[model samples]
Target: MNDVTSGPDTPPLTKALKETAHRLGADLVSVAPADRWSEPPSFDTSTVHVYPHSGYTPSELMPSTHSVVVVAVRHLDGVIDSTTTDTKTTAIQGNFGYVLLNRKLNDITFGLAHWLEEQGYRSVPLGSAGQSRYNHRADDDPDILSVGYGVFSLKRAAVLAGLGRKAKNGVVASPELGVRMRLGALLTVARLESGPLLEGDPCPPDCTICMKACPTRAISLGGRVSHLRCFTDVGRRGVRYEEIKAKFKAQYPVDLPDVDYVDKEYWGNEGTGNRMCKIACVAFCPLGKRRLPDVMRRVKEFEQQRPKVELLSFPPSHEFALDAVGEGNSAAEPSGSG
Candidate 1:
């Protein structure tokens, strides 16, 4: 978080910042030049609108943003894979799990921003939650094309920051964690050396696990994601919860006036049945096969007492996790002399 400008001392300072990020609970961290935003987005953004306003750029977001720091937090080993019909277990994995994890990740980014400001550099922290608003649609076609509202693309920023690559499922795939991680970003005025993008594809060309596992056929073999389909399927519970709430309000205008109507299916009950939504694509990926045994063991233990939801299928590993990337780690290392 040093307020050093672009110079010979910048690299060491960048290394220190990365080390600080790790110490702040980030599983992975990388720095990208603000200029990376200049390139056209991989996904079609022509129809999308960034929040607070559209047309906001890296320069506009921080005016003097010279670098963007991207960070990732690994999901607990068995959390995502432990599917269960038990409302409590499902709620833990589906609804509240991501909400809690995202909050933690956002806090980490805010901490980094605070540290940067303490060092005399201004920073803007982008939280892991509430980034998506809606799907942008063309007036003529009436079909959703891209995100209608957002600030910045965390997945894209993560890629440019050398944290990971994009999988066919439209999620960022980390070399160490596959798609089992959430991302957060910070834009700063500090001029730090940029990290290179991680080499190689985390998703194999022949592997279509995510595409096959998607219940809505939202993912394609060519890497295109149907935003509409994906959102509709995942948001089913939320939609139904809203409908039920409306009905209850209409029928019981005066009963339990102060009590809030809760949806156990959507949010779970007292954290015992909090289910978010299914993430079959994420769970079925072969990249994290090494963690599968542990995941299954936990699933067995949980299902022994309660029936767990069944998965579509868990495929065998097509390649070792190491084989997805080059031999050396692309992550930023701490400077020995810093």
Candidate 2:
């Protein structure tokens, strides 16, 4: 509530808070200003209902002023080892670390929120929609991925939250856990000071192993992602929803309550279960420099789908690959390559 920093006499409060956060089970912790996660920087109103076209202004979402607390969870051992017989269990084991991590952070965040509230400051969790009277929508969209303060998109947010960096695979790579981490955020009404965005780029300029491994050629040279293509591939392969429900039905049914319709659409796989694109894209990226499991390869063959590309790079970020191979509305004559 107090915008003023704790004086020299109270400098340890922030330090204590950080220590408390870790003790409460946060693998990584960082402070972010509430305004940074406001809509304008992240959303497209034309496409999403929650935010305005320029971005979602805080006043439009929450009139009251405040701060934010960002948190991250690292992956656990045995989570990423593809050789594990139960692929479904293995995936959950991988992602559950973050889930548990978030749960712990929520407990601490609310305690911090309460403390701030007692000090006359307002506070809320990063993804606190539906939790209380002041909750807002947990609307993280594909187009506007960076709803919180961080670099790049969600992948980078995880990294900035101190989880890791963009792997040659495009996934966030953690130093302690490698590329095994999930990201989360907590918006608080309190006015805690925000953390510095890390300096020194962790991504490598020479590495493009993830690109080489993609099946659909969906990942561009600039690191931009194609959600539709990735999801389609995931659904068809029975890894996204079907895999989760099949393996963890007893513990974690794939029925996502808030997003059932969207999940079904994605799980439909557009009537095809051939998720070669995602398997290729994620399997081959060198971030963490890991190899694709044999199951992924066997499934690719079973689907009878062969990708036309062996090795390729996206044209300049602005150019379209289709333009080189097909006729278009432009008046220019067709090129020989097309």
Candidate 3:
């Protein structure tokens, strides 16, 4: 890479990168010193591991990784909120949007990487890891969902990048996006000004909305998250989606289906079909709720309108659906059929 800036002191170029990121669709952007990864995690560090192999650090991603650029895009509540339907097709429709959003975020990250490379600095973009790579486990575990490792933990990276703070729900909650954001990162040799970790917790000490909202009790009051419980429930939807897809293929062999089944990417790239159908944990959080009044109202309305079903009685093979209006509709009649 060749340097495009005037001299080695290129803070202006770093500023340009941030501006370009915003223009390229990033809702939140920040730069963190690569050294931040050297420090122990504010939470337990035992569960996290880096790739291409464990015991690696963010600085190891590139020998000259001077700064890490982190970006986040808000997951609009309406898009996720509308998918709470009992219809077998609900998960496919609702989660596809989230999948697309992640794709967009990756595109933006790569775009930033290319721009950095053009500026005479080496850049490496790290999107959500591929399923095969993300699912890879070291010798430590035999059980599923034992804190699966990745190229990097974007949430942890985002927090260190000063874009957000870790919340009790085990999510990086941003002031602008709350828990409703997806993060991506790019490592660069450019010595850009680094952002400081945001001070103070955004989550209310008295509130446990996320804990209560989780159907599987995945989140705890003490902020401990059972990755096993969360991943199992989330992954179960993918299994259900595959089953429905198989039946759909059998019943209408000749007709082309409108929606094809997408396997859930455990790395959180393409969400499982149940993504929106099970968003109560994130949607009900008060942080950044005021920014989207209509979204909050719709979520609340869906909660009131939707009939609750016992988790045990709900078929394990189906995505949990909430009775609610579709996107753009104010009201809708509940389905008579389960």
If scored against the real structure, what TM-score would every candidate get? Answer: 0.67, 0.52, 0.68
The per-model lDDT (C-alpha) reads 0.57, 0.40, 0.58
- Between candidates 1 and 3, the one scoring higher on lDDT is 3
Candidate achieving higher TM-score, 1 or 3 = 3
lDDT at residue 94 of model 3 (Cα atoms) = 43
lDDT value for model 3:
0.58
Rank ordering of all candidates by TM-score, starting from the highest? 3, 1, 2
lDDT per residue (tens digit) for residues 174-271 in model 1? 77887888888888988887776665566665665455444444565556665434443443422332242233233222222254432221211122
Off by over 4 Å in 1: 1-4, 40-55, 84-89, 147-149, 234-277, 288-290, 293-338
Clashing pairs in 3: 2-120, 3-120
lDDT of 3 by residue, 35-72 (tens): 77764544333332221123245676677788889898
Q: RMSD in angstroms, candidate 3?
A: 10.3
lDDT (Cα, tens digit) per residue for candidate 2, span 1-338:
45434446233555665676677666666665545554354433332222112223333444564544555555443333332232323234323433444455557667665655665556554431211110012122224221122211334334334445555344555545445445545444545555654333344564443343344444556565543234334344233322322332222112234642222211111122223342333332323323333423333242234343322221233121321222211121122320
- The lDDT leader among the candidates is 3
